[model samples]
Target: MSLQPIDSTQRIQSLDVIRGFSLLGIFIVNMIAFHSPMYYYDPYSWWGDSINRPVYWWIDVFVQASFYPIFAMMFGAGLAIQYMRAEEKKAHFTSFASRRLAILLGIGLIHAFLIWSGDILITYAVAGFILIWMLKLSGKMLLILGFIIYFLPQSLLSGIMFFASMVDPTTVTYFSSVQDIESSVANYGSGSFADIFGQRVDDWTYANSPAGFISIIIAILPLMMIGAGVAKTKLFEKASDKKLLLSLSALIFLGLGIAIKTSPYWGEKNLAFVFTQDYVGGPLVAMGYMTLLLLIMTAPLSAKLLQPLAKTGRMALTNYLLQSIIGTIIFYNYGFGLYGEVTLMTGTLIALGIFVMQVIFSELWLSKFKQGPAERLWRKLSYSKK
Candidate 1:
């Protein structure tokens, strides 16, 4: 079906507010991924001796499981909203949405290759492409599929770890070896600026190559679909209406985040060394953040503060790229050349500092500018003159 442009002025503030908060969430999580290893664990033991550092430990505990889920939920919300706009205009859906997704994919590829290796935009674009089809599914069905796709991988991985702990202590030991950890850290530390950039280019090329980034992105389709379903139903419309759901999600997220973080069962001997070394705590905190932010948006008193976040959310792509450019210069060898030297706690401070600046800047920028620079271009590119 042909899809139409959504009303520019008729946006729901809750979305922009949630999105603004989500941009911060993305930054918090991406900061860790930006500074540390590609995977959850640190290849180099830069932070190993300091893992017991209180600030570092706390950050890891709260942020690990948080951001991506929030982003996932937001993605779903957007899909629902977009589909609604299309329906409202009585336009066909597939072509326009596909064009948008394709642009996103292109942007993501550039982000992955030219800027950050840990870019989620590509993953989101890929997921969005598939999620559009589920717009016709009943909300309940969409919700069910969302949880199933989202949880299956975690459940399976956890099960494997549980069984391994019981049956193969030696194998787990090998996986957790100090020797392996040390070697990994050393490799990362030794890489030249050129080498790191080369690795990023390679990753982007592979992800966008004929092998297709879409399939890999499929892994997150369920989460995005659920998010879209949530959007369609106006789940965030009135947080008061869904107080129970919000509270429960907050509790579940907090409980799981704490459990996974503090569990000695997963313990110090495991990948906590890896996960804690980066700013792993941002995502955990981001969930708590979203819950609180959504609740706050429902309050009349906080509308002023909510406005900036909504503005930032409106220009999330521009802000996201800004974060990477700023972060890379501050941390990488090509710029400040302080990649391995900065502590996790300090890196997080830097992220928060930059974030506050962006919030203030975004608020001011949007006051005069109609859209983010990139957002304006995107709108121009995505639409034809009617």
Candidate 2:
């Protein structure tokens, strides 16, 4: 097996740190689903009390759609790195990449069905297949196409929603079936393991139905392209070379992201506005967060402070799966049976607590080994058994 480099003092990449940071935000947002049937309920309408309402509002504006983009970009960049390594080694890119993604798909399948339904690994693995073909595109071309492909559909959809809201907002579907929430609570909160599995299938289907998936593709694929482009261009270094410019750009993106993301609250709070918030605003915020983090990490003291995240990020896939495992065990009937019982605040606390443990776990794990357990398994499976 490949080992961690012989030199132990090499600086970790900022990308890994960002990946680790994204996990906390992802878990925080996912905590909503872990504790409640958030998919079936209208977030705008739920969280009735004083405590939950503000909690939801904070998450929606800052954390909800924001961090996933960072994660997606990281995934894309990491794949680009792998592609580069393959090219350097004169390896057959196609067969190798396919096998790797296939392994990911298998892992995702187990995670989605056996553990939890809110799985992005499956989607990423599938997207990796598409990205493999697109890797030949130049960084500039990738960026151009990524922006166009992503924004064109997203803009059109947002426009349609906005116009529809203006016409009659009630027709827009924010929440799914009333029965969905009830069944989810019954199965996940109190029923047997089999019951939770059944509900997992339903939840996965509800989110990934053909029509719904088109939206996911446009959102995910373009970001992947942009991320790959960034990696290919080495843009992070160039952009970061000038702290003043990077800071200004980061502020602008953050300001704009906040403004656009809050449209649902400030202007309409309707389905159309919600779409804009998730699709458009989320990426902007992600860019801002990334730049800002890059800047912070470039500084000596702050970088040292945040180094634990790099350790966690190096083991990101493992931590992500572990999160699902922990979350399921905490919420599912076969485990703690706390589903539908924990509040938003409580779930946030749980996420924070878990992530802290993961940071420590990652540090400890990496000290003695090269990769996290899952990542080691993935690498081993992707290559020769010998």
Candidate 3:
């Protein structure tokens, strides 16, 4: 029999910190998307456009490019860790991972149906099955595959954008309306906090179908696979390695991301349609942000920020769903009904406040409990009460 490696149960502090941090960071970007219509983009109402702007912009820049990638990278790391644990225990990986993924799917379904349409768990669950296969490949192979998958969608999107730019330079499929955008945001924001009954069926269908939510999974699988590769290599375990790579990631991915965001040519429309989609530059930049966190994790000072984040990470599923619930209560017409009314600046503050509260809540919650509420439930279900 092959020798099992070191203790698999040991928790990695850096991973937890990065996870928790990403939880906070993701909301900065997700809030804009969440509060508005799914299709339209309006700066004034979406993120804020006025004198209180610098703060919003600061949040936008810092949080927009930072969190999602870290989450994705951690997903990869988590997958690798699970695989290692399975191997160490001489268990069936596919069966075990599939069970976990299925539970995640169920949780995601509840989130999308009852909470928010912008939920990401379903995508993670779907892509997870495919990611398991890539786990055994070499790091070099996985990295190459990651880039290939990452750009494949972008390649198709770029082709479409190029043709559109040439054929109908005036045509814009995204961000063309303010009123429609408001209507869309209002539709969700104006309803009862949990009154997604009418929309839930449609949203759930869209979320599960290939052209909708599933596309997101296809688009992101590459990054997740790359994350698994990184975990396999023990890259996160070495501070020096993370520092060097993080610097490179900043220069390459972050530089490109900033340039893309600022360029007049890209605009909000392209940013949403061309850049943020499956076949766009957004995920590429996410990769860079992942590196940034690794570098941050290497610094001992980072422990403060990362510790809470790690706790959040440890209970990511619960926290993610909780975000939707919290957002619903605060913004929905049936609840606090702030909706399209909150200024970008105000929303940003609220988001930060909620994040801080969650950190405290999560830390306290975890201290008394072995696993997150949702995580524990998931394990219980997966184990079939064995």
Cα RMSD (Å) per model? 4.4, 2.3, 3.7
Poorest stretch of ten by lDDT in candidate 1: 272-281
- How much is the lDDT of residue 4 in candidate 2? 23
lDDT of 1 by residue, 1-386 (tens): 44435554877787787777777756776776566653434322334465525654554455544666677778778777877877777876777778887888888777777677767777887778778877988667887887676556545655576566678665444233445334323433455766666756654554456545543465467767767766766777768787777777777756655665565325545433233312123334445567777767777878676787788787777898899988877666566656556667777788889998988888888888878887777767776666
For each of the candidates, give the backbone clash count.
Answer: 24, 0, 7
Return the TM-score for each candidate structure: 0.83, 0.95, 0.85
Best by TM-score: 2
Q: How far is candidate 2 from the true structure (C-alpha RMSD, Å)?
A: 2.3
Of 2 and 3, the candidate ahead on lDDT is: 2
lDDT value for model 1: 0.66
Candidate 1 to truth, TM: 0.83
Task: List the candidates ranked by TM-score, beginning with the highest.
Answer: 2, 3, 1
Estimate every model's Cα lDDT from 0 to 1. 0.66, 0.85, 0.69
